[model samples]
Target: MAMPAAEIEALIRAALPDAEVEITDLAGDGDHYAARVVSESFRGKSLVQRHKLVYEALGGRMGGELHALQLKTEVPN
Candidate 1:
């Protein structure tokens, strides 16, 4: 099962309340996704850390409901 876009968005928002997020279905199968997220909370985090925070929001759904995620993150300027 693939994670729903709304679920993904909600998760991110929960982690970063002021986040700006865009999600794209790469395969249209709901298994693969590309997401761009911008948030103030990412300010001091490294790229790996930023990505980890987003993945953590999924709460262990990565290999289950979620298949793959291509993520891009940026801190607010």
Candidate 2:
């Protein structure tokens, strides 16, 4: 089964309640997605760390229910 955009947003929101998140279906397949996240939590984090935070939010689903996620993370300007 593929993951839903709303669910992906929810997962991200749950992990970082103050995040401004946008989830896009990259391939029109529920499994592939792209997410842009802006949050205070990323203030002092590196790109790897930011991506890790998002992957963690998915609870290790990166290679399974959730296929690919191209993510962009930034601290709100």
Candidate 3:
């Protein structure tokens, strides 16, 4: 099954309560998506680490129920 944008956002928010999450369905398929997450918690974290955090929020759905996610992570200014 494909993951919903709301589910994606909810997972991200659950991990980063202060994160500003924007999820887009890139291919009009529930499996493909793009997400931009901005959070103060990302401060001091490396790009790889930031991505890891987001992946962790997904709780291992990256390649199973969810696929092809173009993710962007940034710290709030």
Q: Candidate 3 lDDT, tens digit per residue, 1-77?
A: 88999999999999999999999999998999999999999999999999999999999998999988898999887
- The C-alpha stretches of model 2 lying farther than 4 A from their native spots are none
Expressed as tens digits, the lDDT of each residue in 1-77 for candidate 1 is 86788899999999889999999999999999999999998999999999999999888898889999999999877
* Candidate 3 ranges beyond 4 A from true positions: none
User: Order of candidates by lDDT, top first?
Assistant: 3, 2, 1
Model 3 scores a C-alpha lDDT of 0.95
Q: What is candidate 1's CA lDDT for residue 61? A: 90
Q: Write the per-residue lDDT of candidate 2 for residues 1-77, one digit (tens) a residue.
A: 79999999999999999999999998998988999999999999999999999999989888889988999999998
Q: RMSD in angstroms, all models?
A: 0.8, 0.6, 0.5
Off by over 4 Å in 1: none
* Winner on TM-score (2 vs 3): 3
Candidate lDDT values, in order: 0.92, 0.93, 0.95
TM-scores for candidates 1 onward, in order: 0.95, 0.96, 0.97
